[model samples]
Target: MFPLVMIASLVALGLLVVYYVGGYLFQNRSLSDIPAASPWAALTRFWLVREARFGRRYLTVDDAHKTHGDFVRIQPNHVSIANVNAINAIYGHGNGFLKSDFYDAFVAVSRGLFSTRSRADHTRKRKIVAHTFSAKSVMQFEQYMHQNLNELLRQWDLICQKAPANSKFARFDCLPWFAYLTFDTIGDLAFGSPFGMLKNGQDTIEYMDYPGGPSKYMHAVDALSRRGEAFAVLGCLPFLKKIGHLLPDSFLRNGVRSGSQVAGIAIARVGERLASTATKGTERVDILTRLMEGKDVKGQPLGREELTAEALTQLIAGSDTTSNTLTGIFYWLLKSPGVLAKLQAEVDTVILSPTDEVAFQTVKNLPYLKACMNEGMRIHSTSALGLPRVVPIDGPAIEICGRTFEPGTVLSVPNYTIHRLESIWGADSDQYRPERWESLTDDQKKAFVPFGHGPRSCVGRNVAEMEVTLAMATLVRRYDFELYQERFETWEGFLRKGFCCEVGIRRRMT
Candidate 1:
């Protein structure tokens, strides 16, 4: 009798879930006209969750655009727009498209600029740190950049030194090397100290249980990647977070742990900086120093919690995005030897010698080098996935690219899809040809949004440009690479990241 009752209860629960989900999908009357990516997309959120969990969310959505055209219903309420013209209506300033609830998963100590939804709040936050990312301010960070790059070159030099007696090349993975470079550079710039990742050749870093508490080490890059993928999956269906501990999926489970670890790491860094500031009675010229002194709209200095949150944002944003771009550029360069030669020629003109520090002013305006970087960004988009924005339910009707989107509809322009559109980029849109960027059409310019479109675009754009160009120039001027793998594979989670770019690198003959 007990077993029969249990079976009946289970059946009832299943029926209730089905009924609820069915109603939830069909209840959104405004979304009826938008074409669903698939029947599964229309029926359940499972398909979306699966794609996000397994790290193909961006690709899957891009494929949907190929089949369904510009507007695709990736989720019951979410529409993915692939049209370039829709950019202004959707993401332009004062468009009333607040960041969707999808960003709630990315919240660390508090809502940093990237995760903040409120327009006024985003404005206030941007005001606090925007100057630090400006062109001039970012140039000030080049000293730290050069230091970290030198450390990276030291490690790579040792690897090359170990090459066989006859061979000029030594096998090394460029992706992790780039990761180390970016992480250390950002660490020094943000915290007034480096993570020592480049020197150590490992991702392990120390964190604390709390401020001034016992410290322990964790693999930060792995934690960050796992948390990013996991949070992306869970963010789609936020309810899963509550029962995350009970879930069978280890990735999701580990992501929850990683999130805590990341938070703790941020807290620990902020705490150390505060302690240092108090005891030393002097401040280093770093992002944290500016944050420590920054006043909010109310004229109050940001609290420790806010400072830690911003620090966490900087670590995640400042490192991975630029590193991924660097990796992408290297992958493309190695694949196209002719292009690489051309870029090297341009770089050599400016960089002069292997030991010469690549300055921002020297490399910033090089046309071919700029073209190569632009091409790399276009081909291998870091933030491949669409950043979802909500059409405010209370706002006036907004028309985007000849179609009126109902209020409360979630919308996004998938960067991966728009970038690869044959209409804008011509027939060879899929290729990694730097020459294409040398003569881009007006449509191509509109379609290119690796940083993103409108006011909410990446605030750290200047810093990213300085980091990438300087690093790439230094690399091309110093080494010649032979790729180990035939294909450069990438996966899309929080950002599109390469698995690895294994190469046989040797000192440049020049």
Candidate 2:
């Protein structure tokens, strides 16, 4: 029995050695064959560790491109390419590259628009809700947005009026305000019910007595989604997946539960909208309404489950992204008095007056104001990190800055890094200079991509721009703002979400 056990152990040891040797050989061949850029050192084994530890892991991959040229190998299997031409080849229409499993962290129920891996699945899902955000649908919902903005302006005016005679005015956190506005706006559009955020001046949505408000729960979910990426890297080792769950029950489970609760709210809201369609008068025609009532290319109405998932995805994407952008822009405006004055001047000249109400279309046309907004977004990009995409099976070898990446490799181009590229935007790229935008030729403007570029760019771009334009125009018109606190530090976690800004606003006595 002892002899037999020894022989079995020897065989297992031999198998382990063969596996390690084969892995090393494969990695060596892959790294050696690639025509990588001069800067990329050929060290395959510790690439992931170096990227996670030494490198600016939190800075968007765009920084990597600026430092390492257009294509930089991040890990053995991962490369980040920031070339404009590659955007078309990779994410353009009919591009066969699938979203990498890195996005699996973003998925909730193994199905949903953002979570689904297949192109066909995405097409079908996108089709069902396409009309909801259509030009007409957005126009129809203008009243809802206008009402919310009006309320927000009213609150600001009251805050301005109530400022102490001697003491500085109440410093406001734009993050929460934008969060309130965005959640209320999306809530009204998606569920036909505003969370009354503007009414309450906060996110007061109730679900299981979760602390830190609904937005906090949302933030938790956003943070938890990145855990799967960590798991994937660690799980490459034996028994890691099984052991990972045993490490500790952190915010992940709470986040998943919160996400599920949010999804449940979306599902319930859809049902309520459908039930009240008869009496609701014209159905409001929000994205949720169109999604529930619209048909696919096959002329088939979306299934009930599909409708719920799509609606939930729209609410999350639409609300969170716009909120983050607004918060970032507002923080920047508060930080720079010069930029704020310029933006205020532009607003006053174009859209702001004692009797004139700021309209989205009019505000959007103000070039300086637009430049300020664009520059703010460029510097403090919400979607700082690049969306990961896997190379297609039979696609051409991706060549960037003289280096060719192999097919089936994962690549990303973080907007955070791209926006800061000195070569593209010149030396003031790191500085918040709206004038730089004014001086740029049309060709230069093409590189400013806060909403991303190409066919798969943000579907809600128009709505987001309009919302932000109106909000900023309104705030600038009524109040002269200053940063109450000097330095604002960012908490870098899952997304490049902004915080730590406390601004004091006073009513313009003109």
Candidate 3:
């Protein structure tokens, strides 16, 4: 009698496992019309996770869009929509869409603007920090940009002189140079001082308080990025996440360790700023100071933790975005000689001295220069994957791609796929053509989402655009460059993904 009872219990357990394992299908039956990336995608997040693990998830989204039309099921509940029509519905302020919990993986402790899921919280934080990133406020950082770009040019000048006279070009990887320059710029803009990356030609984050000898802020961010890539893919699986936490002394922990190090740097910078200002009673002008001084809608200033998180957010987002966009712009320009020549002509016509810093105001309104920038940004989606946002649990059902999606459904639009779509862009969308911007109709222009669309769009975009435009025009005005390798390629990391190749550079001989 006891044995029979035990056998019956085992059978019931097996049945329950099967039902719940396949429950994703039954729950999402309303999404039957939507095409899945694969048969497995409907059952598990592992399929998408596999693409992410290989660092080709962007390709997966792009391939799915090509095969499945507009709406593709990336997971059982998650769908990727490429049409511009969904922009206002998903990301619009009044649309009631909230950022998905997927961003929770990025936050170290206290959630900042990038990862916070609470609408009220984000609204308050955005209100507090929004002024610091405004056009007028961002221009205050222009001097920092000029100083760093000049230092970068000085480094490249040294490399140019070091080149053998017989050689037509000097080989220098703009990848790290861009990184160094951007970090230094952000450092000076964030704290009262730069990281000295440009002066040193290396990523050096000095912490007088740190016990260990060397500190590279960019390296910490890189380590965090690698681990973020891993977590982003694998963390989708609940069992895998559980297993990850169980592993002792694993590489996964490095992400948090690196993030804490970055946090330490921000905290240290804040402390220094606070300390100097308090004792000396001197005013220090930087992003951190603004963050500390700014008040939320509640009229509450940021606490120490909140202040650190905001500072770290600005540094990471600003440096990576500017550096990567500049990298993409140069890569495209070098790959297309006619485009390069045209851009150079445009810049040369405007600038009296190639050696002087490219002033932001001078290049800000240049048509071809702006066109080149827009093209580069479109070709290389800064975010890579779709910026995922969820349908609010309490909001009304919405229609997308001729189907109704109830609350609790997930939606996103991958910038990479949308930017390269043949319908949105012409058949030559894959090609680098700055001139395409000139003929863009109202509909075509609406699809352009380099800085994203709506209120939730990147706050640091103004600063990023100004600095990139200035830096790119400056480089083109001063140097002639060619790709060192026969072909240019890059791996899509979590951030700063573009042009992982050496460029042969030389002073343009007039």
Candidate 4:
């Protein structure tokens, strides 16, 4: 009886192993059963190792799209679609896809607005803050924006003046300046207190410190995010969570502590704002106030935890993305002198005086400047990496270029690859030509998705654009700048961090 029982147990264990392995292999099945080209074969084990060790060659992904046409499986269970039609199908409203576990890394504080994976949950969270980003709410914050821009311009003027007469040609990267302006603006708007980045010329956020500067934190977060992806992959194992606890406490502690600090700050700020109804007039009308006053579809007020998560999410989303986009714009403009001149001409023509506070209406009329901003966003999208989404159960099987993706298949459309595709944008697609935007028809414009498409598109996109336009206009109109470093290299360690362009600046003679 004992021998028979041992043999049965061994047989059961063997079957279990076979079952799991078969499922694993089947889950990662090739997408080539349909008519799509097998372009991913080129990116074999050797190539992946090289690509992983070195940084992501976004240019290489662009090249792959050219060779493979619209749809190509770039990795095992991962595919890239360059077709414009696919964008709507992949990320459009009611697309029936939820963000994949790849986004789980961003869940720093218990599933905030950005970290929520469920379509229903996202809709609920979005509704709570939808009014805050409406046209009316943004206009209300115009004064706050103007004040921040003025602060930035004042600082730049001082910096330009301080350069020694002999060394007046001193060069410094405009990236840091843009970073300070973006973070400071978001800091004030979100937390009601500036990180004092613009005033101090450094990131003095109590918990987080951008050692090499604000840009360095971008790099660190990118690296850490990649590590988090590895953890998620490992999490598939049954006992991995238990093993995770055995890993270094510091790794888990830092993330938890940082999240707690951010949440604490946001909670405290909201409490303070709510406490002082005396000063809660138009001046206190930031995103926080809007959120505090908001109620869900069922007329339930957002709870304290929900408010904290949402607020911190806004702070992160508003600050980093805007900073990255603005940095990219400055980087490109400084390199292309003619583009800079054209932008300056538009600003000068529209604003009449560069130093004067730019009203929303005046800034809106500068089509060329707007086009330039759009082009920069397209060329070097801050959200360059593919935002992964999982296929929903009971949804129509997604067919991309004759290839069928089953439910639960992880899918994405890499923006970096899509934006630079020759088939979509013509030969000079990779070049920074804002004029290309002018040539685009309405249909083509609809395909141009820097902030993504549909309801899930960036909530703060309008605010971000306004901030970038005002900052670029103010800087170009006030200064004549040259690239300190000629070559532009992007370090895509994780979230396209260390992506900067160094430049030299001198105040233009009035």
Candidate 5:
């Protein structure tokens, strides 16, 4: 009798879930007539979560767009939108949509620029730190950026110098070097000194130096990214973390640990800066320095939490985005020697050298170099996945294209898909042609958002562009590189994949 009662209760609970999920959740509340990618999406974000866990969300969403047209119901309350106009309504300044709760997963600290959801909080933070990213700041950061670039060139020069004469080529992977260079550069700009990555030719972030031999700090960052991928999925399911042994890069282990470790590094570096002030030396000139002294209009300085959060944001956002794009730029350029030669000609005409540290201002105005960067960014948008923003149901009704979304709806536009949309770009959208940039209309130009758009866009955009342009100009003018490794693949995750370009570089005979 006891067994019968238990079995009956279990059966009743299963039917209740089925009725609630299938009957109620599947019936579109206010997202009238928007076609779901599958019935599963209308019922729950189960399909989306599963795809994200495997790092295949973008590919899956992209396929859905192709099948279901521009808008696909990604969840019962979430819609993945991919059109040029959607960008303005969703991400443009003054839009009422707040960042969705999906962002809570990325807040390393309690608060920061990247993860802060409230528009008021974001704006307040943005105003206080805007000076750190000013044109004057970029000009000052140039010397520090070049110092790291010089080290990178020195390292590459050593490789070229030691290569066998018969081959006249050194097989080297530029990915880790790019990571190290960016880390060192951002370190100098944020911390008055670099983490010694370029100088040491190794991972500098201490937590990354785990038991399985040493690894790149960015690898831990990557693990954190993949960890977000797992959480974004497993979070939808309850008690999945209990089976921690089954999940290698599960939420509790790698992601949280890596994120917490990176945050500690940021906080510790801040502690170091605070301690250095009493020394006989003048004040350290870096973003963090500016941030510390900066006061809001209300005469309040940034609190310790704000300071640490912003500094970590700079290190992570500034380093990864630039390195990935630089890697992408090199990947595209080497694969297309004709484009490389054209860019080389454009940059070489400026009287730069392989051995000389190229200034950001010198290459800032170069047309083809700018074109190459833009083209590379388009091909591999750093923020390729959808930047999700929740619609305000309490405000006016939101209608994207012909579809109307109710309040509390989640809207995301993927630049990865939009970048290659045949309508916005030409028929050759899939190709890596830099010249395509020259003929783009103003509206077409607005559609390019590698760093994102409006107030919420990347604050370090200028610094990133400066670093990439200078590095690209310097590298192209100095060496002619050929892709050495036949097997090159992008590491796919919630953020980006592991796309590294291993190239055989030889000094130009000039």
Candidate 6:
């Protein structure tokens, strides 16, 4: 009996090995033309998964693109393309390509605007809130931005004044501070009330205990950060999400908890806003009110669930992306003294007071300031990883990077790699030089997609730009930053998330 059991176990092990090897050989044969990032990458999705787990997926893919020509197989079926032309072909309107299943991992409540895969669904969702995100609409919300900006300045001023006994400069981490400002600003804009993150100088926020029950406080920013990292890893091969519970990885388990917390927060905010409107009958027009008034695909007001999803999307999209950009702007500014001086001079011309809330119109017109913003965005893109898209399984083969790829092939144009392409941005593409944006050719312009391109581009682009510019101008005009760390460290997630950026701030004498 023991001999017979051993023989069966040996047979099962041999069969599994044969299956894996056979499948690997078949995949290699099919994608024979494209170069693989590694031998294991051509065999399994686990290679990319491991890289993502370690927060080096973007960097690893970027290196592979540099080694291989235009395209590199980061996974068996997924190709990471460095060509700018592929952006339009893959993400442009009427381009047959659709968002891959990778996005489904990010669906916390429901498929929000950013996570939705269906073209029709995305179009419907876009129409519902398009006006709310327009430039004119964003302009209406400038007061909220200014309000938070003033609060941020007040806090910073106190810190600077209380600088260590004899030290002229005060030390603080800009990343969390920026996060607090953006979080409070977006919460006010979206939910009709600020989260008070800025005033408290913490990432904690209140959410519903139950319907009309009570409110609970949680570390909202930490959850969002962990969610980004977990989602980035799981999204690569969404199947992992199913068996994720069985896995012993603490990050994945913590991610699930974090996702639930974010979802609860969104639900509570939406519910509270709705309850306030119904009972108080206040006449205020904010993003939430507009969304409440907007019609859904069925020509009816959006349901609570749908509203929660969209509201949650706005909070996530508006906060980290803008904060990361602002952090990058300051990081690069402090790193390049010449650039910082030129930008400070430009900002000084427009900004009249240290405590004044810098207007968008004034800051928007500053050429050198705009250059630094563009350069910072280009060099330290928040969404550094490739936005993944898929060829239709039933449609004809599509062309990218002068190569024909069949349907069902995953194509990702990593912005990190594209922004640094030597052919388009010249040899100094890797350098953090604001002067590069002074004269951009048509080709270079096409490649500069910090917020992405096409119909699916960020609807909140106008708002994000306004917030980042306003905050950057205000801060740069008031204070001079000295870097505490020699190098800026970044972690990979859905967006290229930032770690702490510690710096010494002193009130500018001039």
For TM-score, the strongest prediction is 1
The reply for model 3, stretches above 4 Å from the true place, is: 1-23, 206-218, 234-253
The whole-model lDDT of each prediction reads 0.85, 0.64, 0.77, 0.66, 0.76, 0.85
Worst 10 residues of 5 by lDDT: 207-216
lDDT of 6 by residue, 268-296 (tens): 98888888878997566678887888886
Candidate 2 Cα deviation (angstroms), residue 68 = 3.5
Model 2, C-alpha of 31: deviation from truth (Å): 3.8
Error of 4 at 69 (Å): 3.4
Instruction: Write model 3 residue lDDT over 1-510, tens digit each, in one string.
Output: 569989998998687556645667577888877899888777766677677766788888889889988899888888999888777678877888888767766675368888788989989999999988877788788887888888888899999987777897888788878878888888888887887877876665644233233544445436535555655654454345434555453554554455566666766777677777788865656688788889987799998778877887887788877778888778887887698889888888878777766788888999999999999888877667887888889978888657789889889988888888888798998998999988887667877887778877888888888888888898889998888765556666565375476889888755
Task: Give model 6's TM-score versus the native structure.
Answer: 0.94
- Model 2 stretches with alpha carbons more than 4 Å out: 1-28, 32-56, 60-67, 207-253, 278-282, 352-355, 441-443
Report the lDDT tens digits of candidate 4 across residue range 116-148.
888888888899888888988888777777777
Ranking by TM-score: 1, 6, 3, 5, 4, 2
Q: Candidate 6: list runs displaced more than 4 Å.
A: 1-29, 208-214
The window of 10 residues in a row where model 3 has the poorest summed lDDT is 207-216
Candidate 5, residue 147: lDDT: 87
lDDT of 1 by residue, 182-248 (tens): 8898899998888999989999998876788899989988888888888889888776877777789
Evaluated against the true structure, the overall lDDT of model 1 is: 0.85
